[model samples]
Target chain A: MTLVDTLQTSFKAVLSYRLRSLLIILAMALGVAAVVMLTALGDGARNYVINQFSSIGTNLLVVLPGRAETSGSFLGAVLGQTPRDLTLKDAQLIGRLPQVRRYAPLNVGEAELSAANRLRAVTVLGSNANLIPIRHMKLAQGSFMAQGAGSNAQIVLGAKIAKEFFPRTQAVGQRIRLGDSRFLVSGVLMSQGETMGFNTDEIVIIPIDYAQTMFNTTSLFRILIEAKSHSEIEPAKQAVLAAMKQSHDGEEDITVITQDAILSTFDRILQALTMAVAGIAAISLIVAGILVMNVMLVAVSQRTAEIGLLKAIGATSADIRRLFFAEAVLLSMAGAILGFLLGQCGSLMLRLAFPQLPAWPPAWATITGIMVALTTGVLASILPASKAAKLDAVNALGKK
Target chain B: MIRLTAITRTFHMGEQAVYALNDINLQIASGEYVSIMGPSGSGKSTLLNILGLLDKPDSGCYELDEKRVTDLSETEQAQIRREKIGFVFQSFHLVPRLTAAENIELPLTLSGIPSEQRQIRVNEALQAFELKQRAQHRPAELSGGQRQRVAIARATIMQPSVILADEPTGNLDHQIGAEVMTLLENLHHRGTTLIVVTHDRELGARAHRQIGMRDGKILTDHTDDAG
Candidate 1:
């Protein structure tokens, strides 16, 4: 038969047997939509993490004490191997590099800040004046600490800390006792919501020397360095390592982590995760393909008499095969078009419900969803189509 | 023209070989109307199937229109069937999903006839069969007489030289059966070769010649005047 005639015949069959056709189409569509939506979630999580890291400031480096390759510099003290202390002097030498913009030396401790009998336990962070620019922090009221370093009593309170410490009074120009020392309020930091697992608004800030005497420690918690430009992060890391080795009697005791390295590591892990979930969702598509095979086989058997009649009316076996293939393509094409719409709608609902997620269907996932469904549909059709083509006319007609 | 030489077809009915057509030699000229009548399992249908190229012989040869068609490939046989032979079944064999007009155009469509030409020919067939008013009706909606007429139209739409009817009236009432027979005979009168297989003596007697079968062999042949 002419290709157009064959196509028309197959379409008419599909329309006439609406229920069976709809079952196959629905199976395929759900499979495709699942792939799209699941991948959107996985990739969305990756993007969310990347954006969080990006907000911590670009061209950044995190320097930790001791050989982090041998110690989880995080849990080294608990593990009985003490990491060498990193001091504010090392932070100064690292800042001298032409590629380095500034470095924030951090030391964390707990303190009770009392303003008129209002005592709240708060985490106190100690850093230099450059901490404000290096960490990309802003002040809502007053200025940050004056640059000359000593055991100065100037302190900045986080927005939440200031409000909780002095409920009815102006927080700037207020005095709060830190251990045995009284400090004057220097600035009230703008409220920064939780970022990279740290809540800036919930903490108190003091100069590095004052925190050292209060906590009785010469070691720093971490040194956050911002490179002069994006391309200088690697050079800045090298300069810090060189300076640490030269100053510490040639001991290579620190681990430097660049923002690019950390970001790429996260990117790789999340990319793999997205692919794994997509693969899992694709299993449903295969099940749908098998369903197509099963339904098509049943259809061929049910239409044996029709096949026989076509043969009797001079239809070649090729014609019969083509007609069946046309039916399969028609079914899958309809399913693909419908699935695209369903997947898009599903993704839209997801984004609406989770505004922070940045959920979107990736282009590759969408293309693969439809293409894989089409490929599976064609593969599934081969067996039933061949069976129909090979049917003997007289036997198919149920005649002896 | 059709020729068969010592054509033999066999079937195994649980270990015993039964011949459906045994050593049968027959020749039919183009445009001749013939009827093959036999009791059940007498191999009348098998013989008709062999003549129509729908079945193959176990040990014999078949030549149609002076071509050695017995050993032709399945595709070749289908082409010959499309261009030269037509079939009308007792059950009508109309595709239930298709309307009367589509059913009538089936063979032409299979032969790759263009849509414009297919449309014209189908319209003519609808009018000729007095089914124009019912052209859009599916097989379920058509009367027995109308379904049979639609099948006849489909069978002849390719303009085949031979039309094979296997009890074309067997499923109809007497009046409707007579009406179908008249249609087949009218086509026969127009010079298309007609072969009808039926056990009804009345139907068999209406053909120009009759062949009787029993025990897988032709027992009698005679010239019969058209009723």
Candidate 2:
């Protein structure tokens, strides 16, 4: 028969058993949609993590005061114990390195800020003027603190703190009492939204030493460092470690983490996650394949008389097999196309619902969905098509 | 023309071997009208199936138009079936999903005939069977007589050399059955060889040559009476 004739017959057969064929198509479509949507989510998460990290700084490195060499005993804490406090001298020493462009010593604590009779508890970030460049932050008004030793009483207000504390008045020139010390506000930061789970817009920034005096602590929480260029990141890390060791009495008690290292670690984890999600989704597809096989078997048995009639009208066994196979391929193709459309729409909806996630389905995911669906269909139909082909014309015709 | 010699077919009923066709030998000339009549246990269907190449005889040398077809491959047999033979079943095995015209065009479709030619032939067959208005009706929508007419139209659409009909009018009323019989006879008069298998003696008697079968053997042959 012509290709058109075979297609027509197969289409007619599928339409005749509408419910059965519809069930198979629905199963296949859902299987494919699951594969696509799950992969999109996984890939989106991976991309979002990398994007969050990249947004922090260029060629950046973080110095935390701790030696994680005894990491074996640390159960849930990523921040290891600090053998000795990281002093401002250590940060100053790191800043002297040729590979290091800038560094900001940090001291974080919580305190109540009272201004205009409105007092609210706020997280206090203690850093110098270099903190703006190192943390990639901007200001909506007023200048950032002048770069100097850690002795200034000038402070900056994050956008949320500015709007909440001094709503009717200019917050930049106001003096706010922070834990008994009064400080002049030098800047009001722009509204930078959430990043890496922290909202920088809701904090107050002050000089490192004043913060240390208020909190009565000497250890720096973290030191943010930027390498002169992308190629200098490793050298800057080694330099910073050496400087910290020198300042801390020749003891290696600090962990220096490069942005590349963190990025690669997250990249590897999310790659595996994407593959694992796809594999899990593929299990559903296999189940759908088995459903296809079961339905085809039932169809073959149900259409015994039709098979006999075709054979009686001069259809060879090969013809019968081709007809059945054609029907299966058609169903799978239609289902796969529908599933791809549905999956894309689902991915779009997910992105719309959570705008932070990059939920666009990748090309490989789309191709895999279609190819796997078609392959499953062909594999599932083989046994039933062969059975139909082997049926004896005389006996098949005798079936009521 | 068809010829069969020493055709034997056996079936295992539990542990007993029953000979469905025992050493049956027969010959039919071109354009001849013949009937095979028997009781239920007789070998009427067995002989008809073997003659139609729907069954394989345990031992036989069957020839059609001087071609040795008994040992032909399954595909070759199907090709012969497609090109040179037609079948009409008692239950009127018209594919219910297809319209009457499509059902009549089934053999031509299987043979890969172009749609234009197939459409012309189907239209002609529908007209010849006086089923023009019912051409688009499915088998379930047509009466017994109309369905049988469609089946005959399908059988003759390929213009096959021989038509094998098994109790073609068995399910119809007397009036409808007579109409169906007249349609088959009309094809016979057009020089297409017709072989009817029936339990109805009246249907069997209408054929020019009659063969009576019993106990898997031909008990009598009435070739001398030419209707």
The clash numbers for all candidates, in the given order, read 0, 0
Instruction: Give lDDT tens digits, candidate 1, residues A1-400.
Output: 8889999989998898899999999999999999999899988999999998888887889888866454444555445354468988888888887888888899999988787787778899998887887787889887767655345688899989888887788888898887778999988999988998899998888999889999999989889999999989888888889999998888778879898899999999999999999999899989989998999999899899899988988999999999898898889878877887898899899999999898898999999999999999999999999999999888777631
Against the true structure, what is model 2's DockQ? 0.69
What lDDT does candidate 2 reach at residue A185? 87
Q: For candidate 1, what is the DockQ-based docking class?
A: medium
Residue by residue across B1-227, what tens digits does model 2's lDDT show? Answer: 89999999999999999999999999999999999999997999999999898999999899999999999999999998888889999988888888999899888888999999999999999889999999888999999999989988988888998999999999999998998898888889999999999999988988999999998999999985446
Which candidate number maximizes DockQ? 1
| Residue A378 lDDT in candidate 1 | 92
- Candidate 1 lDDT tens digits, B23-98: 9988888899899999999999999888888889998989999999999999999998888999999998888888
Candidate 2, which CAPRI tier?
Answer: medium
Show model 1 residue runs off by greater than 4 Å: A69-83, A140-154, A162-187, A229-231, B225-227
TM-score of chain A of each: 0.90, 0.89
DockQ score of each predicted structure, in the order shown: 0.73, 0.69
| Per-residue lDDT of model 2, residues A1-400, tens digit only | 7789988989999998899888889988998998889999999999999999998888899998776664565332245455587888888888889998988989999999998788999999998888887888888887667645346588899999999988888888888898899998888999999899888899989988888899999889999999999999998888888877777788777889899999999999998999899989888888888888898899899889889988887888988999998998888888888888889999999999999899977789879988999999899999999999999999999886
